[model samples]
Target: GYKGDQIRDFFLTYGDQGRDVTVNLASGGSPQWYGDPQTEDWEVTLVETGTGARIKRVAAYLDQPYFLQTYGDGIGNVDIGALYTQHVASGLVSTVTGVHPTSRFGEMHVSGERVTEFNEKPTMADGWVSGGFFAHKREMVDRYLDDDPDLLLEKKPMQTLASDGELGVFTHEGFWMGMDTFRDWTELNGLWDSGDAAWKVWA
Candidate 1:
């Protein structure tokens, strides 16, 4: 939703309050942590890189053996700890969170030209898709991912990983939705306003 530097600036202000904030404007940018370290429940870091940089370039800053990645547009009640545990148990280079996506069109059941039942935007009964909550070992970047700035994560890297049998999947049957449209934005806001947001797993 936020364009240009709006998202970065918002987080910078939010993190700068009652805490120190530092930003690096160089290549291979450093970790820009937000919020107070002692009291904050989670850590937020904004890593700056060149425009049109590849995902692997940004990932080069990752110092940990394992890390998570996801698109900002999707929200869900995915269990992060469980995902990490599954990744470890599977011993794969990466683990992708798969979800049954809701259909864009309404479903209708008919018998002899008589409308029997109808469901609006129902969740599909078959097939799971990547919901973007990815848990990856550092080896994935070292092996599968490339240094090309034009490389897309969903393209060659994922394809190669699956072909190599190193990509595991963690299926999450709970609430998940992607905010790619205005309708989705309104629906998510309505849920939050009505206090019925299923993705709000925290107190």
Candidate 2:
């Protein structure tokens, strides 16, 4: 999934060292590695899965009772410490970050042809979408994950969790963005330049 020392370097920048980071990536059949990086404390291992391996492959390397899995490109200002606490308290197999996606267009409430209320790029309050930040218990992964290589983490597994009343959600009303396109990259850069990034949780 992830290549090179970028992850290691990132954590080093934040003064976190000697961390074991496991990344699961399934391109076509499984993950393929590129090379090795020489680092002191940080170590990132790449695990290969099929296109549908989803997050199940991570169960193999999940050392802790609880592990956090976040998309490399997704950024948010979620209180992860609090999320961990909630997951433990709820005793669910999994807990994921729930975010209200911002509307691409402005919203207008009209009353008798009069613009009563207008909100520009407002956050949607109807349904929440998963922000790709996940916390999972070993048992959850062990019980749900299979080697089929066609399973989707967000599909049947998640649905089963919901059906079994085992899914927990930590709602975040703050900003959440994924750097998927050039426009997204530019927007994040703009926020960085303007010092107005809502996802900046660090000092």
Candidate 3:
């Protein structure tokens, strides 16, 4: 049902526009289906370790001393440049953008152009959670992660980093949402079509 040529053509069109985007299919355990990456533009980034490596797995592929990282399925309007600058100034090994994700279902009283009151989901008052936008020092990976692919980046490394004062945080008081449900998908599509998506950073 899927035509590889058509997809390749679509990619080529984008490539022609000077977009140096590399589509990587990461397959673990034993490489099946996608045996090898044939084109120079696209590649199969292989991770031989078992599974559940999470950020640690992806971090290994990066060659930069510091690289921006974010969840592919999450959308946010965080000021990335500010976060990077803060990270550099703090001299921390890792920095996660903390955010107050909009409440899923809540009641808000808006007067004129301001919200008078909102009683809903846990906000920044409840405490901040990792927004998935990160600036990581690549060398920290080897210091924190091991060969075990089952390691979760959030479990020990992050905690240890925080405990050792080696981690920094940038709070984002802007729009943020994770697309995880059908409702989220529909709403994101609606927002995209409406041309009012707050996370449209380029605009």
Candidate 4:
């Protein structure tokens, strides 16, 4: 079974502070980028579940040019920016910002041609991009979930979506962390006890 509360918490943590965000859960493989190639846009971030570290800025975009698959090992093998570039070069996608990786977190960043400047570091100043939290629009769900049963909605889907510009990012300006192992869980609990969880929402 899925951790409904955890899902709820995750969505609430990323949802707009005062707006209503609907989270739909379906039994499947993963979620994919679904939106108009011309209008939708988004960004990607690497979140380490064990250490709760938002390693780097990954990618950004607004179409379904590529798809990444997650095997049994749990790690995703996404080319990050290759798909978008191919699409843009081939004219399948509009002329948008190119994709690049960051230094601190080793994540990728994608921007449109209109995106004049780029930030190297993640901070509360940049809507907490380094924190790995995001604020997505309702349309993200509507397009991504277009009655796809096999869609798992996992990390790969997110990566592909962000890379394709189907999702937008609303970085949070607080503590954030991901728990992927027993050690990480313990450490996160300790941080919570000491009042230092970056992703703490109910505190």
State which candidate has the highest TM-score: 1
Winner on lDDT between 3 and 4 is 3
What does candidate 4's lDDT look like per residue over 80-180, in tens digits?
25433443344321221221222344233557646555564343232222222222333444444433334445454466676786543322223334445
- For the record, the alpha-carbon RMSD of candidate 4 to the native fold, in angstroms, is 18.4
Give all candidates' CA lDDT scores: 0.83, 0.78, 0.74, 0.38
Against the correct fold, how does model 2 do in TM-score?
Answer: 0.74
All candidates: TM-score: 0.82, 0.74, 0.67, 0.31
Off by over 4 Å in 1: 1-4, 15-38, 41-43, 50-53
For candidate 2, write residues 69-134 as lDDT tens digits: 787778889889988899889889999999888787899999997999999878889999998888
> How many clashes in candidate 1?
0
> What are the per-residue Cα lDDT tens digits for candidate 3 across 1-203?
12445555665554344433344467434422323333444543433333465556666578777877665568888899999999888888999998776667786889999999988754545677788898988878788877566677778888888998998999988888888899989988899999979998872
TM-score winner between 1 and 2, please give it.
1
Off by over 4 Å in 4: 3-134, 154-166, 198-203
Candidate 3: clashing residue pairs, number: 0
Query: Per-residue lDDT for 27 in model 3?
Result: 45
Candidate 3: regions farther than 4 A off: 1-13, 16-51, 54-61, 107-125
